[model samples]
Target: MDLQAAEKRTKELHNLLNKYNYEYHVLDNPSVPDAEYDALLKELVDLEETFPALKTSDSPSQRVGGEILDMFQKVQHHSPMLSLGNAFNEADLRDFDRKVRQAIGDSFSYVCELKIDGLAVSLRYVDGLFELGATRGDGTTGEDITANLRTIRSIPLRLNEQVSIEVRGEAFMPKKSFEALNKAKDENGEEPFANPRNAAAGSLRQLDPRIAASRNLDIFLYAIGDPGETGVRSHSQGLDLLDDLGFKTNKERQRCASIEDVLQYVEGWQEKRPHLPYEIDGIVIKVDSLEQQDELGTTAKSPRWAIAYKFPAEEVVTKLLNIELSVGRTGVLTPTALLEPVKVAGTTVKRASLHNEDLIREKDIKIGDSVVVKKAGDIIPEVVNVLVERRTGEEVDFLMPTHCPECESELVRIEGEVALRCINPKCPAQIREGLIHFVSRNAMNIDGLGERVVSQLFQEKLIEDVADLYKLTYEQLISLERMGEKSVANLLNAINASKSNSLERLLFGLGIRHVGSKAAKTIAMEFGNMDKLANATREDLTAINEIGDKMADSIVAFFEQEEAAELIQELKDSGVNMEYTGARPVAAEESDSVFAGKTIVLTGKLEQLSRNEAKEQIELLGGKITGSVSKKTDIVIAGEDAGSKLTKAEQLGIEIWDEEKLLEELKG
Candidate 1:
C-alpha cells in the first residue's frame, strides 16, 4: 500500500483494535471473534512494516512488544506516591474512622477499593497519549518502565479525552496467567514463581518487553497524582472520571457512607475473595472528599485520609522437620525451623524463623512436631504456635549450639540480648554475611555481586573481607561458577563503581552494631568524612540529632577496633572514596537567608513547584520542612486550597507565606 493509504488504514486499525481491546479486557465483552480481530491486526502490522512512519506510539501493534532496554532509568515522580497506614482488624478500622471523623466531622464518607496483590505503578499521559510508566520506588523516585507497561492490554494507549494527566495504579498478574507462567517455567526446568504478586513484579521489571507482554498482566487505575488539576472534588468521582477517560478501574469498589458499611464490605469480600480471578491482599479505604483529605493532612510517611485494611493471613499446620542455625552479619546466631513443605498464604512454606533460643524455650517448640504456620502480612512465614496435641512422643527437643557453626568459636549471650552471638571478628560466617550486606542494594549497591556470587567468592577463598572486594581481579571473578567473560567484566565495573559512592553507603555497609541506613547517613553528614568519624568520640556523636547514646557508643567502639583501622587503611590504599559527597545540611546559625533556622510546614498543592522540589530548595536554604503544622512552626507555606494546616497556623498566630512569596524568598 502507498504511504498515505497506509497512514489512513493505520489510524482506522488503531481505533478498531483499541475499541476491541477495551471491550474484551476492560468491559469483558468482545464484539468480534478472535480470528477476525487477528486478521485485521495482521493487516495493520503488514501496512506498518511497509510504511514504518505509520506505526505511531498509540497504535495497537506497539502492545506486542518493544526493543530490549539495557537498564531502567530513574524518573522523579510528579507527586510523591505516599503509602497508606494499615488496619489489620475491625478495631483498627474503627480507630481510623474515629480519627477521620474527629478531623473532618461525621458527614464525610469513604471509597473502598480492593488492594490488588501487585506492584504499585504511576502512569503519565500527555495530551491523551501514553507517555510514561514507572514503578513506585521510594515514593519520590521510580524506575521508568513505559515499555513494559505498554504491553498490558488493559492499559489504554490513548485516553478518550485529549488531556494531560498522571494516574496511580496497581499492576497485577491474574491467578490463571500466573499459574500458566509458572507451569511453563516448571516444564522448562526453571524455578517457578512463588505467587502472583511476585510474578507480576518480575514480569513488569523485565528488560525485554516481550516477556512482560507474554505474562498477560492487567492494571486498575485507582488514584490521580493531582486531583485538583482534574477538578474532582471526591475520590469516587475521580475514579469515575478515570473510567470515562477509558482507564480500567476495579468495578468492585464501593462507596461507604459509614464505617459500618465499610466493615460490611470488608467482611463480605473476605468470604468471596477466593472466587476472584485476581489476588487481593486487602481493601483500601480512602476519605471520599478531596477537600476533606487536605483538611485531615498527612504524616511523614502516609496520608491521614486513607488506610488499608489488610486481610487476615492464611494459616496452615505443618510438621517441623528440623531446626537450622545461621549467623548474621552482626554475628548474632538465629535459628530457623525447617518445615515439611506446605502451602500457606498462596506460597509453599519450607521454613520459619524461630527468632531466638528464648522464644523456642518459651514456646516449647520441638522438631518433628506439628506447628501452626502463617504468613505475617502474607509475606513472611512464621510459626504461629505449636500444635502440641498432635505432636508425637517421637518429636525431639532442639538445643542451641554453644559454638559458632562455621568458625567453631565459643558463643556468648550479650547482656540484655536473648540471641547467642559469636564475638570473634574473623568468624567465617560473619565475614560472609557482612560481605553480602556490604554489596546490598541500600549499601554499596554493587549490581552484579548478588548473594549467590558473594557466597561463591567466599567459598573459593578469593576474598576475606569487605576491603578485599576492591582488590578483586577480572581473572579471579571469571574463574568462579556461572561467571562468564561479560559477567565478570560487569561485576568488576560494578565493584569499582561502588568505591565512588558517598560515605553513607560505606558506613551502612560496615555492619556497625546500632547504626541503620538513616543513622549512617546522618552520622556521615555530621562528620563529613570517614577519618573524622573514626576519630570522633561518643560525646561528639551523641551531640548530633537522632544519634542516641547507644549508637554513639557503638560508633566509637567500631572505630576503635584494630581490625577496623587496618580495613580503613586498606580501603584507602585501594583508592576508595571516604568522604561524604551528598548535599551538606547548612547550620541555622551560619546561614543568612530568611528561611534559615525556621521550621516550615507546606500545605496544599503548589502550581510552581512540586512538593519534593519545594522541600529540597527550602532545605538547601537552611529551612527544616516538617509534615504537620504545630506551634513550633516558624512559617507555613500555604498554596491553593490550603486546609487544616493553614487554619492551625492561623489559630496559633504563626507567620504564613504564599507560594509567590516563598518563590521570591528562594530566589533571593
Candidate 2:
C-alpha cells in the first residue's frame, strides 16, 4: 500500500481496536470477536513497523510495550491524592454523617463507592490523549508508570472529550487474574503473591511493561483530579463525566440520600464482597456536593468530606492441633500453628504464622486449645488470641524448639533479634531456602526453577548451591520425574537468562543477613561491581548514607567468607554478569540543584506531585530522601493532609515548604 493509504488504514485500525478494547475491557461487552481484534491489531502492528515514524505514543500498538525502561522517572500529580479517614462501625458512619450535616446543612447527599483493595494511580490526559500515568506515592509525587498503565486496556488511550484533565483510580487484578497468576507461580515453583492487591502492585512495578501487560490489570476511575475543570459539582456527576469520557468508573457506586442508605449499602456489600471479581476492603462515603466538600474541608491526613467505612476483619475460632517449626534462608526458626480447618475471610484457615516464640508465649497458645484466627491485613493468616477462658485442661503448653527442625543445629538468638537462629551454614534447610531466594522474582528471576524444582534438584543431589544450577546437564534434568523435553528446555533457557542479571540482583539473591534489595542496589551502584564491593572495608561501607553498622558488617562478613569468595568465582566462571547495569541515582556531587545536599521529608497529600515525584525531583536537585522527619531534616515539604511529620518538623524548627512553594522553587 502507499504511504498515505497506510496512514489512513492505521488510523482506522487504531480507532477500531480501541473501541473494541473499551467494549471488552471497560464496558465488558465485546462487539467484535477475538479473531477480529487480533487481525486488526496485527495489521496495525505491521503498518507501524513499516512506517516507524508514523507510530505515536498513544497508538494501540504501544499497548504491547515499546521499550524496556532502565528505571521509572517520577511524575507529579496535578492534584494531591488524599487518603480518606476510616469508619469502622455504624457509630463512626453516623458521626461522619452528623458532622457533614452540621457543616453543610441538610441539603446534601453522598456517593458511596467500593474502596477497591488495590494500588491508587492518577491518569493525566492532554487534548483527550493519554499523556502521563503515576502511582499515588505519598499522595503527592508518584513514579511515572505511563508505559505500564497503557497496557491496562480499560484505561483509554484517548478520551472521547478533547479536554486536558487528570483522574484518580484504583488499578486492580480481578480474582481470575489473581488465581491464574498464583497458579502459574505455583506451577513454576515460585512463591504465590498473598493477595490480588499485592499481585497488581507487583505487576505494575515491573521495569518491563510487557510483564505488566501479561498480568491482566484493570482500573476503576472514581474521581477527577480537578472536579471544577470538568464542571462537575457533585461526586456522582464526576463519575458520570469519567464514564462519558471513555473511562471505566465503578458502576457499584450509589447515591446515598441518608446515613441509613449508606449503612445499607455497606452492609449489603459486606456479605457479597467475596462473590465480586475484585477485592474491596471497604466502601468510600463522600459528601455529594463539591461545595459541601469544600466547606467540610480536610483533616491532617484525610478528607473530612469523605470517609472509608472499612469492613471488620473476619475472625474464626479454630483448634490449634500442633505447632510446627521451619528454618528460613537466614537460619531463623519460624514457628507455625497447625490449626483445625476453619473458614475466615472466605478462605480455609489451616495454619498461621506464629511470628516468633515470644508472640507464641505472649498469646499463651497451647495445642488442642481453641484460638481465634484471622487474616491480618486480609492476607496473612495469624493467631489473633488464645481463648484462654474456654481452654480445656487437656490442652498442652507448646514448647519452642532448641534446635533447627531440619538439621538439629543448635538454635541461638542474635544480639538484637527475637527469633532463634541456626549458625550452622551447612544446614540443609537453609541451603534449600537460599537456593529458592536466589531464583525468586525480585532476585535473579529464574523462571521455571521454582521452590519445587529447586527442592527436587537438591534432594536428587543434582544441585547443592546456586552455582551448581549452571552445571546441570540437559540429560540430568530430562531424567527427573514429570520433566518433559519441553519443560527441561524452558528451565535451561530461564537459567541461562538469569546469568545476565545485574549486580544488585546477585547481591540480594546471595541472601546476605542484613543486605536487602534496596541496600544491595545502593551498594551495587556505589561500588559498580562485585570485586569493588567485596574489597570494601566496613567503615567504607558504613560511610554511604542509608547503610548502617549492621548492613555494613553483614556485607563485610559475607565477602570475608572463603566459601563466598569461591561462590563468586564459580558464578563468574559460569558467565554471570557481576557489574551494576541498572540506572544509578543522581548523587549530590553530580547535581547543583537548590535541593542539593539537603535532607528532605515529604508529608501529607500533595496536590501537584506524588510523594515519589517530589522525591525524584528533590533527588534530581541533589537532595536526599528520608522517610520520616528528624533533627537531620533540612526541609519538610508539606502538602494537603500533612500529618505528624509536619508537626514534628514544626517542633524541630525545620524549614517547611508547602506544595505551592516547592512547585515555585522547582520552576525557578
lDDT top scorer: 1
Provide the overall lDDT of each model, using Cα atoms, as 2-decimal numbers. 0.87, 0.86
What TM-score do all the candidates reach, one by one?
0.52, 0.55
Candidate 1 local distance difference test against the native = 0.87
Candidate 2 deviant stretches above 4 angstroms: 316-320, 323-337, 340-372, 375-668
Q: For model 1, how does the per-residue alpha-carbon lDDT over 1-668 read when each residue is reduced to its tens digit?
A: 67777788888888899999887788654556555788788899899888887878888888978899999999999999999999999999999999888888889889999999999999999999999999999999999999999999999999999999999999999887886675444323244566798999999999999889888899999999999999989999999999999998986788899999999999978866775678999999999999999999899999999999999877999899999999877677888999999998677889897767877898899988999998753556888889889866999999898999989999987665566888898898989999999999989999988999999999999999988899999888877778999998898889889889999999999988767787898888888899999999888987676676767888888888898999999999998999999786576678899988888888877999988789988888888887556556889999987765787799899999999999999999
The CA lDDT at 580 in model 1 is 94
Report RMSD for candidate 2.
21.2
Q: Ten consecutive residues with minimal summed lDDT in candidate 1?
A: 183-192
lDDT of 2 by residue, 434-552 (tens): 99999998899998988899999999999889999999999999999989999999999999998989999999999887676777888898899999999999999977866777678
- Against the true structure, whose TM-score is highest? 2
lDDT of 1 at 605: 79
